[model samples]
Target: MTGGSTHEIRPLRFGVVAPITTDMPAWRDQLRGLADSGFSTVLMPDVPQWQPAPGPALAVAATITGLRVGTWVYASPVRPAWITAWEAHSLSVLTEGRFEMGIGTGRPGIADQLRELGLPLPPEGQRWSQVRDVVAALRELDGPDRHTPVAMAVRGPKAQALAAELADTVTFVMPQIETRAATVQRVESFDNRRGAELALHVPVVGDSVAAFMAGPDTDPAAVRAADSLAFLPSDPAAAAEEIQRRREEIGFSYFVFGADAAGALAPVVAELAGR
Candidate 1:
């Protein structure tokens, strides 16, 4: 009960949550910035806060070669399964086969957020059904020449079953598990099989930047300082070693970071991106 899109992901790959920007000039710059800065891919969240829609933004970013683009995890409850299908097909064309459709049962707070948008958040059981519907639709719409990988971000046992059966990449987000053993257990629970990729959407911040930003007059806004977000060690080499050890135990090949922490995390990217 596994899906078929394996050629798209690689071990030790890194991607960043795209920075928000309304103008094309800045958007293009940011897309190129990721490529130049050594991120393997660029991810756009399918949240209301984004300026351009995730599919369209990925399409635009695809104009730059060698940069893979994806929706970090589209909240399936927010739209009909067919609409989700449309996005997958559209992004496949838009990115010329360089897109990954990441889907999830929208998170907790999003229910309140969706209420503001005049959309009700469906229960977990219903959202799980829609997730299956979306997967089936994507498979039906896919042809040999036009295809997009589906990345399922799910945590529960039922949802994990759906992900294992229908996703190309299985993603997990567990920022609260602060220990290596805890992180390893979380990833092991995915039980990723052959022909699938494992992507862990987690925090990554280097030590040097944290130390520098701790100075008395450090501008919080300038550095996007947040102690909770800095999860890795300070030294680039030390971070690389820790990440390598984690990857060995957890089998997570793809790592994603927050948009604001890109500058702080770049040193690790530099240290381990191409290796």
Candidate 2:
């Protein structure tokens, strides 16, 4: 049976990961446009020297009614777990239940970033431990009354196990060149462990690939040929159908796209969000 049979089907939800790059008024307008276009959440990535901190950026996005805001993901090893949890809990309170905390053990090449910042680069096991620590601290700060949904961006078996235990949403961080069959295997492995909402991160919509997601050498044709879930057809109808197929075959209900594809994916979101 497909992974969908292993868990309850969640309503389709769409989020946009767009780092702040404009003036306050312009950024506000962009956020409003996303909300107007039927997007549910506006997310920011946590990369030093690339964009403003996601917590403050998300706090601003949460000002727009009906639009939720979150960190596309906070790298757990970048800061102490308690500090990350404190900021996350504060943002949760500021957003008034409209914030979702997405955290991970940093991305590929994170070791270089750590070295650049004069921080010690811990081993993989330690990084995963930090992720768990962040969640535990966040829970303690939240206590029993407040519940801030945690979304974990996981890749390896250890991460998958941790996510199954702690996350409200699990986002699989697949490679740019990973084949469809490989992806199904990854999804099914997690499904066997636990039942949380599944999220698919789409970095390419049609021919346009977000630079943040794909490197300069990434070829769109190659990704499409591999049948990667990271790529989606730009056409609204086709994209919607493909999304539905994914939900049925692999159990992904939450689809997050890069900011560049926001306009292109709007119609699909309009047609399928909440269904």
Candidate 3:
């Protein structure tokens, strides 16, 4: 059963995962466009080799627009937990509490990246400890006067438990093959365990799919056919209805979309964000 009946559904919030594009002026314009378009947050991915470091990039974005700035997620295994915490705390203080720290164990193939970087490729449990350590350090740094929101991406029982205990927001990640029924069950299970805000990461909005969301061989039609949370209809009215359906049926209130969908969904954002 849908979990909307069990808990208070949160107000709708929209975020865009926009990587830093060329020149500063362009980046500023892009961020301002997102803010003007009703997006609440602008997030950066933590892939060091592909983009400028997320910390500095996010700080710059915070200065350019009134929109909140954050990491779509920081990979905990790539660096020391204290260092990541320090960066997160600095961003929060600089942004005046407009920073949301999303942290998780590194994603699939992260081990190969670690090997290339000559870093330790720890066991799954050890990676989670690093995530916990980052949040703990962030708490110590934030102290009583300030609070920096933590969004943890979890896919397993132990990770979900840690996120339930420590995160202000939690996003569940699952295999691409997982159906809507399986996704709802996972969210319901998490709701049974904790009451934090729930976020859904949308990789395909309409016909556009972010490059990082899928491989060259991955078909957008296939993802859409699976009724995946990653897919959303392109039509503004239809997209709005579907988003509301998700909130009603799955209790997902925070919807994060790829940069590609920002323009396509602006009308939907205007209609439903914060409503």
Error of 3 at 111 (Å): 0.9
* Clash pairs, model 1 backbone: 207-234
Residues 1-275 of candidate 1: C-alpha lDDT, one tens digit per residue: 12332232355888777745547786677677678778988888776764667877777678865688888778887888998888888888766777888898875477887888899878888998998998888878886566578888887788878877788888764433235555555556654565567776654454222221123343333332332222555456776776676566555567777655666667888778856
The lDDT values for all models are: 0.69, 0.86, 0.86
Q: TM-score for each prediction?
A: 0.81, 0.96, 0.95
lDDT of 1: 0.69
- The total number of steric clashes, by the backbone 3 Å criterion, in model 3 comes to 0
TM-score of 3: 0.95
Give one digit per residue, the lDDT tens place, for model 3 in 9-108.
7889999998975677887888899999999999998876887999999998998889998887999999999999999999999999999999988766
Error of 1 at 41 (Å): 0.9
For model 2 the TM-score comes to 0.96
Q: What would the per-residue lDDT of candidate 2 be over residues 76-193, giving only the tens digit for each residue? A: 8899999999999999899888899999888778999999999998888999999899999999999999989999999988998888889999999988879999998888867434
Candidates 1 and 3, the one with greater lDDT? 3
* Model 1 lowest lDDT segment of ten: 207-216
